[model samples]
Target: MKGGTKKIELYDTTLRDGTQGEHINLSVQDKLLIAGRLDEFGMDCIEGGWPSSNPKDEEFFKRAMDLELRHARLAAFGSTARYSDRIETDPNLLGLVGCGAPVITIFGKTWQAHSKTGLGISDEENRALIKNSVAFLRNAGREVFFDAEHFFDGWKDNREFALDMLKAAEEGGASRLVLCDTNGGSLPHEITAIIEDVRQHTDIAIGIHCHNDGDLAVANSIAAVMAGAIHVQGTVNGIGERCGNANIISIIANLVLKLPETGASVRDLTQLTSLSNFVFEILNLPPDSKAPYVGRSAFAHKGGIHVSAVMKESSLYEHIDPALVGNRQRVLVSELAGQSNIRYKAQELGISIPEGGEQIRKIVNHVKDLEHRGYQFDGAEASFELILQKELGTFTPYFEVIESKVYVESGIGGRNVDQAVLKVRVGEEIEHIAAEGDGPVNALDKALRKALIRFYPEIKGIKLVDYKVRVLEEKRGTSARVRVLIETGNGRTTWGTVGVSTNIIEASLRALEDSMNYHLFTLKATEPKPAAEENH
Candidate 1:
């Protein structure tokens, strides 16, 4: 197992902490899959959920016992023993010892207010719980991590009492003392001050854990590291309850790329992006495209000036080589695009266009005009490619639509059905087809495919995965021009096409037509065929 510098240890709680986010849910199998991936990504530790909480967590720990992890050691999480007569019979403590994990992390209330009101315990009793819990878990042959919940707020409220909790845990043989920003309200300066002060008085190694309610979790974590922290704990993509935990994604990039002297680095830094998206994919949630280092748009260049600069000297616009983190630079086309945009996009899409020619100006002007009329070519590159083919006089209509009609009707049993009737011509033969579907778009898609499948059998493989419509002018209400974007995929690949019109159905048909046309172009491009006959 390859590990990061011993100066700083990486602990991930995504399986436990990440699942607390609003839409984040994972099965036991899902957690196990992520654990293996994290180990492969070179994580130092993976926190399995508190086994005492539910049966799912217990099952997760049981199943995780055979993970065959290469790098990360699995840890179990729980709070210290509840204030009870006998610590030996504590269920939470017992669950921690027998969770089949080598490491155990137990959070105890350090804030005097929480200890008094939340736990209904005195200061001395709370200290006893924290100390005794660590001792009990250590005696069970498990390495103990003591998380001081609300540590910063506790220090600010009563500096001496907070210091006593650390002493209590250390006296009981805690291996690592983690200071947590439970409410996530501490600023960077406060974190620096508190962690430094705590460092001087504590004997155990200090770790940092932060929440994102104040939106400074990452900032505060870095601040804590500079102060004295030697361990960092967070969830991937910052998924957690409320705002979130500190984003381990951003933290890892900063630590490895910017603070390597701190001995924090990953095994393969290039796999960072795949890891970020993998977690989102497993949880079935959309990734935040603007996220640093790993997001789709992180290195995408849009403005004409920026693209021009990036083309000449990539360092002028890009902060770092996108390939360093498994991302690439993309030049976007929009109404704001210049001739440079057209030239760059042509080469990027593998379409040929002469540079500094009248054809380039015409294409640029046409793009501006179309974008002014509610066409967004930036997101629909397949639609833009069709425009390029048309300008070059190399595009041919695979199937021409002669006429189309669509309508929705209610059934006898309160069922609603939409139907589309399409008259399409492939070569000299005409196909008139009608298909019923759940909605207007689906009906159109089905009817169009049925009309063309006889000639292009490959049309059966295309599936409409996404369809979205945007109103250009909300004030015009039903009279407003609408823009439609459709996404099509064939298991192996996906492409987007776009359309615009005041009539929603007309706009949909335009996007659908573009999608089918682009699919045919791709099919012909990859398959061996006579060159001149394809252009017809």
Candidate 2:
């Protein structure tokens, strides 16, 4: 490999440190599934959870033994033995040994503050734990990675003692030394200087782990790599305790897309978006649409100037081709959108508009008018598409609502219940249904789904994922108009729809109707052609 093609090792601790996130709780099966997914993306190492901390992690290691991981080496994570016990007697070391993972990663205190105050141990004992733990693991025929916790902070406090800790790990037969920014407070310049100092003392392979406390985890990790670190430790989407860990997807994007000369390709960059969404799905969390490289909005152009410039020369507004990372550019329509924005969005929706035609201009004016009336299409592309289709003479009515009513009652039981009755027409058939729910919106959703599910069975798969209401005008106080945004998903795909009206219930209904319509239209378009059309 050339000097430019410096192969940087990619390590994922999503199952371990990532689980430290408050909302993240993955089952053993979830860990196993994510491990395979990471391997599929060619991750160099996947750190399974710590076996000594909990039974789930221990069980995950037990189950992971049978997994046929082709690309990633599974690593078991744990901490060094405490000061009171020897490595052989430590339960933490025993758990790591029992896991039988080929690689073992253990973290130990390097910061004098942690040793003197936090761990209440002498500085000599802390260094002893680092040396003995690595030696114990290495003698057990396991590849040991000694994580120097708080290395950057410790170096700032006492540079000599910090370097001494690194020397102790190297003497213990450790294969790699991982410097951790545990508190996530160090800046890029501090990290680079400290890494340079470490390189001067030892020639061991260096790795970096960072937290996003200062919103600089990505920046700090990149700085460490430039300063000679070979391995980068991070979670899939930066999910971790407090703020989060460094996002490896962004790091890989930088290394592969921006630093082309580095020749550091973690996996097929085209699979990044799919891999990001898959992990979020397993975690049962919504993907951050604005996340760099793989988010929905990463390539979406919303401003009129941006839309026009991108349509002419994408490089004017976009830094890279979104397709390179399994994403695509989106031209959004809004009040600020010009004719070019309207035409570009229409084309993206598979609708053709004649050059210099009135249809595009019409859409531009209609969008502006709607925006003035409190409709936002930037976050609700599905609703924007429906509006475009209706104006372009391509939309067909899926169903028509005749009348709807919602009633709320608080009886002697002291619990409020909402009931909704809906009447709708699908061609010649009229369906009237009533349902009870915890709230008016819930009741309305249940009633509408009940009325349409039999006629459009595909509606059954559509689940409402999120609902948010925003006041468009505060001056009106209780009578103010509100905009409601609803996010719906059909197992694999998610879409946003928006509606605005003075009445909250009406606004919610409008958004709900648009959501179902969008889903139905998509199903109808993708449905196989009839026998006659196929024969023709």
The C-alpha RMSD of each candidate to the native structure, in angstroms, is: 2.9, 3.4
Residue-level lDDT of model 1, residues 318-391, one tens digit each, is 88898888888888889889877888889988888875668988999999999999999866999999998989
The digit string of per-residue lDDT tens for model 2 on 306-383 reads 888898899898899999999988877778889888888877878877778777788889999999999988779899
In Å, residue 486's CA in model 1 sits off its true spot by 1.0
RMSD of 1: 2.9
Residue 75 local lDDT, model 1: 95
Candidate that would win on TM-score: 1
Reference-based lDDT, residue 247, model 1: 95
Report model 2's TM-score to 2 decimal places: 0.89
